[model samples]
Target chain A: MARHIYSCPLRWSDMDAFGHVNNVVFLRYLEEARIDFMFRLAPGDGSPSFSGGSVVARHEIDYVRPLVHRHAPVTVESWVTKIGAASLTIAYEIKDPDQVYVRASTVVVPYNLAEERPRRISAEEKLFLQEFLAEEPAAV
Target chain B: MARHIYSCPLRWSDMDAFGHVNNVVFLRYLEEARIDFMFRLAPGDGSPSFSGGSVVARHEIDYVRPLVHRHAPVTVESWVTKIGAASLTIAYEIKDPDQVYVRASTVVVPYNLAEERPRRISAEEKLFLQEFLAEEPAAV
Candidate 1:
């Protein structure tokens, strides 16, 4: 099993009136991490290809602790937890160097843009995802 | 049970590469609706009051359909699904005039920001929340 970790920068606008990172802002951090993971598998060129795009069908997030504004960058650890024929699950851990702030999961379906429908993961794409697969459960 | 529905304007930046609302942007819409619902309960007059401030402890979202960019506003319907001693639940639906796009729930904990701690819902606050209490389950 392998993991892909991304370092996400924090912007001042991410904070709410309470001086903590707004709960909704965490989703953006996770999105960046997921995009990084996917692109790592198939780097985007200037043109489109047969590589299937994906859409999030579901998301679950548990906030372990409130993340206050800080100078340090946050790390988002993500890995594929399961890969069905047409969908896959990605699990994530968001943390600063000192503490974990969130644990989350997203269910993503392989999508066909031209057909406007979901499609099964190609053998090649599934092999690519296997490189970052984790044996652990999708949620904590 | 009463429900508070908010009309949220869509920003161009909210769209991702897929030409649809990014999965993460939906959280911001839900947050906006939740804030409007709370402020309606206890309008802020520049002073602190016992109508406790809240923090999101968890969020679960199911994407019923992808939302495409449009000129019209999106509607977010929010209601209080449960109120415990120190925490409450908010359910939401994101939709346009024709169809539903997302169903979501957020678990929120009442907090005393000045004291930096979770606090019980005051009797008055509890009574106010009862107006929006939803007898149905949190999500569809």
Candidate 2:
């Protein structure tokens, strides 16, 4: 089971009045990690890389701990938790060296942009996702 | 039974390679709407306004339609759905007069940041939240 980890830089604007990183910013960190993973599997030249357009069907995030503002980058670790014929579930964790801040998952569906509908994931793409499939379900 | 609706401004940075606002940015929109509602209830001078601290326990978003980059602002309509002694649920809809782009909900808990634990919501705060309680659950 392969897992991808990306270092996500934090911005001053990402902090909320609580002096901790805003909950919304965690999603951006996960997005950066997910995109990095996707591009590695299906490299593109500044164009639509996935077999078809991909849209996030749903996102669920559970905040475990409050992350404070820091100059150091936080790590976003992501792996495919499940893969269906037309959709895939990606699980993510935003963490630092010591503690995990959030656990999240996003359901992404292959979409046909021109037709504006859901589409099937290509066999090659499925194989790509399988390469990083988690051995077991993500505990979140 | 008052509902708050805010027109959120979009920035180019919010757009992703998908030629539309990234799913993550929708969370930011919801945050802005939530903060506006909070400020209206408890006014503070650029400091912590909530009694102690309110942390997002969880966030769930369902993307109804992909929002493309537009010059105009998108309206985020929000109202409280349920309130407990320690937590409350907020429901939101992102739209632009014609179509709804997303439906989302977040569970927020009154937290004791210094103590690093959840705290009970105060009576005064609960009273403030009740002012904008929704009559029924969100249809989406």
Clashing pairs in 1: none
Model 2 regions more than 4 Å off: A43-52, A112-117, A135-140, B42-52, B112-117, B135-140
DockQ of each: 0.87, 0.81
Model number with the top TM-score: 1
lDDT of 2 by residue, A1-140 (tens): 87888889999888877788888888878877876777555544245546347788899999988887878999988888899988899988888878989988999887777887888877767877887898544466
Question: lDDT by residue for model 1 over A30-110, one digit each (tens)?
Answer: 988987777554444222322447789999999989887777789999888898988899999998777899999999887
Each prediction's TM-score versus the true structure:
0.89, 0.84
True-structure RMSD for candidate 1: 2.7
DockQ of 2: 0.81
| Candidate 1 lDDT tens digits, B44-101 | 4233533446788999999999887787899998888899998888888898778899
lDDT of 1 at B108: 87
